[model samples]
Target: MNLDDDPPPTDAAAALRLIEDQQSATARRLNPDARLLYWPWGVAWLVGFGLFFLRFTPGERALVDLPNWLPLTVLFVLLAVAGAIQAVASKRAYGQVSGDSARRGRWYGYAWALGSVGVYAGLGRISEHLPHDLAALLWSATAVGFTGALEMAGGAIWLDRDLFRLGVWISVINLIGAIAGPGWHALVVAVAGGGGILVVGALARRRQRQRQQP
Candidate 1:
């Protein structure tokens, strides 16, 4: 309507708009809370798998290679998978400092432990009736060695302090199981491995809640 009218805004107005744009971008960028979206879902699936195997019907049991041992097999698989997911999620957890070595700190290291269960089941079938001590020794040695490799590699990869500690712990567990046999190995993992994870998880949760509050 008027060539004489000043073009939409002055240089000062344009500069002000540019500053606001930059601020808006920074505010909207990804933040740690973004993780909350997927975390619950992952946890739900993790628990669901646990309950599923626990409640396996006889019919379902017949399907697996080791149907009678379905509960144990399923349990280990679930544990290993959870470990893998943790590893992956930890890596995906961006814009935050990572405390673990890349793959070593993850539950996938648990995949080896799970596979060892499969080995136990296979061994059970081969013998008319395999002894528990023998099976436990086999599983323990394999689990510890595999877990150690994972931890060692992870320690090397991320130079994680925890990985080295974890490897030491796993190796000790393995050694004890091999030396003492099954009965004691079960006690060690149940009391030490499982219990330790629970304590760690609880502490981490408490810390996380505290951070979110402020």
Candidate 2:
């Protein structure tokens, strides 16, 4: 019996074992730290946006009526923190993955950063012709919706199904918000955009934990 010349395993048990091994290898190649960072960042964005939207609603006047700069300040602070976490996670992922994957992730980050700046600038330029409130609503929806598109692109690049699904869900939510118009923009953004991010984050966390388990 020559082992080198033997046919590959084709029985049900053998096939199952092979599949499991492949999955294990894929899991091992993924960045655990990156997976862990996602849900918390999502939660932070949810809280930040929730507070920002409070100003327009009657129920949370305390949050809404604070100095105009306060909410913006808090939101930016949270974003900075999230950025730091992402940087750390990226470093950890870089250590584990190939150079090409790390470089891809870096370029993806750059694209998002540039895209955000472009969205803001473009919105500001065109806002002059529209009513103030309508312009603001359009700005918010477009900016946030662009983020979703980037997520979808990243998911496709990485072959991450969950992230891809999250991107689609986010785009749908933003579309609904747009259709709802300026009157419901704040509420839609808070409930749909923020909440969608939170849900996606939680799903990512759960999937990561399951993959880590024996």
lDDT scores for all predictions?
Answer: 0.50, 0.72
Per-residue lDDT over 46-135 for candidate 1, one digit per residue giving the tens place of the 0 to 100 score: 343233323432233422243445545655666556656655554455335444433443454465567667866775675445564455
- Regions more than 4 Å wrong, model 2: 1-30, 58-64, 128-131
Q: Residue 107 error for model 2, in Å?
A: 2.0
Instruction: Give each model a TM-score.
Output: 0.46, 0.75
* Model 2 error, position 44 (Å): 3.2
Q: What is the lDDT of residue 145 in candidate 2?
A: 87
Top of the candidates by TM-score: 2
Span of ten consecutive residues with least summed lDDT in model 2: 55-64
- Top candidate when judged by lDDT against the true structure: 2
Q: Candidate 2: lDDT of 50? A: 69
